[model samples]
Target: MKKILVTGSAGFIGFHLTKALLERGDTVIGYDNINDYYDVNLKYGRLNELGIKKDKVKEHQLASSELYPNFRFVKADLCDREYLNQLFKENKFDYVINLAAQAGVRYSVENPQAYLDANVQGFLNILEACRHYPVKHLVYASSSSVYGSNTQMPFSVHHHTDHPLSLYAATKKSNEMMAHTYSHLFNIATTGIRFFTVYGSWGRPDMALFLFAEAIRKGEKIKVFNHGEMERDFTYVGDIVNGVMAALDKPATSNKEFDTNIPDAGSSNAPYRLYNIGNNQPVKLMDYIEALEKAMGKKAKKEFLPMQPGDVQKTYADVKDLINDFNYHPNTPLEKGIGKFVEWFIAYKDSKLK
Candidate 1:
């Protein structure tokens, strides 16, 4: 049983990953600030599912899960370097998965400082801790948004991502660079997974799936950005978690074939690598909505709007590296994924009402 530290353990993907690890007999320390980026109640609800009561969680204090003996949770901010160092020094973790970040592209437009604080400074703290503590593997979350302004059909890790359209994308790109630096200098086996549009049960309210679901429930108009001209590789959260586990099991190694003359963007001579964890199936925005409508038993009233600032037109992830390296393929059908999400959403909403 490996001892792992999962930052952003209260978030959507983080929560699912933590549960999976615990079920697999891994000792996990779930850490999160439980920030009010969205509804705190939803975060608390997720924590509750992990046998961590909302009242039991205190800042920097570890709360043991009642349901899973292998799981423990700590409420803390990623920006707190001193606390992070303390936590790392206390626990000799086998692996560390850094998923905590100030998410959302458009939100970054209004508050760029948040991204810098959490994504930039917060990530530096994780790197420092890993450098000092020396973990077996360090896996962190990157996003498909990094492939900004690149009209490539299937976005590959080899593609040039120097042109980020939004602050969020820029910060995510900076994360990959920062991670590569640590891997090069400290020999930290770091792997960055660029996630596509992940959606499922307990998803972020700010995301399209959740927004559309809520609007449809209220008989309100859901804002269709880019006038429904958008497309996304809508990967399920379950698939993402499985991909992360696969990557974590296989630590990155130096690429002997890496030629400095034409350096590959995906892998380096240093112990650093990048992979895209997406469905590889780009679903149209309108089609995605239709699937959701079928699941919810109600059609959404969409408010067709111009493309918002800091938003990309489309995202399609090329998972060739993921398939070749890990032999893992994310094949969860969009309709099935959306159906599961709707079921969970309705149940969760009803629970909240009671």
Candidate 2:
């Protein structure tokens, strides 16, 4: 079994990916700071479902069990250079997946320093550790927000991503650049995934789907930004996990015949690559709300409002490259995915009440 290190293992994507890796018989060392970016209880609740107790988590502490013999958890901050170095030295992971970051565009506007500390400096520390102790592949999360104000119908990895509308988008784009530099200088196999609007069970509360679901269920008015005209490539979480696993399994190789004169943003002469992992099916915001309403068996109290600062009008992903490279295709329909999410939401709420 390959030993893999997954940062942010308590986060939504990380949690699902870790479960997948564990089920595939891989030895996974999970790391997370478990910061109170949202609800601390919710984070702990996720860990509890995974059989990890609060007391077991400590700075650099490792926990394993016979039931999930290959699974382990470490409570460590990625920004801590010494601790991260120690983790690299001890674990010697075959692959490293960095999914931890300060998420949310509007949140970045209010807490710019948090983004600098976690997304920039923290990512630098991960890259440095990888440089010192080489891993087979490094897969990190990028965002569709990197497309910024582009008028393109579907955002493609080959297209130039020079404009970022928000601090969160800027940090993600910066991560791709940093990864390219590392791949160029150190020959590290790095792949950056520009994820669209991912949603499903165990999703972050800050995300639109989860927030709207909770508010609507509570009989509260749901904010409809941009007068509910926004469009999003609302991808299912399971599909995203498949894309990430595919990228991790296939390490990027340098394009020997890459033309320097007319360079492509998605590929390089170095061991680096980028792809957009989305459903490739953009849905109108109102349509998405309608799906949620069907799942909830109730209509949301709508409060139409102008677009919030740092929010985009629409996002669509061009996943042709992802399909060509990995045969990856997202198959979940909005109605089906929303139905599953609603089921989980009800169960989770009941469990919380108990």
Candidate 3:
């Protein structure tokens, strides 16, 4: 089994990805700072699911999972270059997945330095470690928000992502550039996955799905941004993790037919590639809310509000490259996904009450 290092293993997508890897019999080393960006209990709860006792976790120390013998975890920040270097020296990892970053567009506006420290500086440290340790493949998370102010429907990997509206988006775009540089200079096989509105069980509380559910449960009005005109290609976390695995298994190769004269943004002559892993089906905000309402069997109080800054009107992914390269298709229906999330939310909330 391949030995993989998954950064941000305590976060939403990272948690799901690490669980899948462990279940598939791969040896995984999970790393995360477990900061209080959201509820620390939720982060601890995810660790608990991974068979990691929160009390046993200590900074810069490795903890083995009780359930998965092949799984181990370390509570460490990515910016700790010395510890990162030491970790890489100790573990000759076959593959690396960098998912650790300061998430959320609105939060970036309030705390730009957090994005710089985590997404920019932390990612640089990962690149450096990968350069020294030399992993077979390095797959990192890029967001559809990188599309920024592009009015284009179905954002393609080939589209220019120069006009990022938010600091978070800009940082993600910077990661793509950084990865390309490492791939070109060091011949590191790197792939960037641009996720579009990923949601499912154990999702982040800051996301709309969880927020709306909590607000509805508390008899509070759910905030409808852009006056309910927003749309998102709400992909299932299961589908996203599947796509990630598909990419991880296949290291990026130089595009044989690449033309430097007319460069392709999606693929390069170097061992670098980018793909958008999305549902390819955009659901309107109101319709998404309706699905949640149906799942929970509760009507939501609505509060229409102006669109927040650094937020996009809609995001639809053009996953043709992803399909052609990896045969990945996100098939989870909106209603079905919502149903699964609502069930999990209720159980998790009730468990906390006890």
RMSD to the native, candidate 3? Answer: 0.6
Cα RMSD, each candidate: 0.6, 1.0, 0.6
Superior candidate under lDDT, 2 versus 3 = 3
Model 1 residue 339 CA deviation in Å: 0.5
lDDT of 2: 0.91
Query: Which residue pairs collide, candidate 1?
Result: none
lDDT of 1 at 18: 94
Model 1: weakest 10-residue lDDT segment is 309-318
* 1-354: candidate 2 lDDT, tens digit per residue: 789999999999998899888889999989899998998777777777677887777777797643477898988888899989998998799999999998999998899999988999999999999999999999999999999989888889989989898999999999999999999999999999999999999999999899899998899999999999999999999999999999999999987778999998999999999999999999999999999999999999999999988888888899998889898898899999999999999898888889
Give the poorly placed runs of model 3, Cα more than 4 Å off. none
Task: Report the lDDT of model 3 for residue 59.
Answer: 97
lDDT comparing candidate 3 with the true structure = 0.96
TM-scores for all predictions: 0.99, 0.98, 0.99
Quote the positional error of residue 167 for candidate 2 in Å. 0.6
lDDT of each: 0.96, 0.91, 0.96
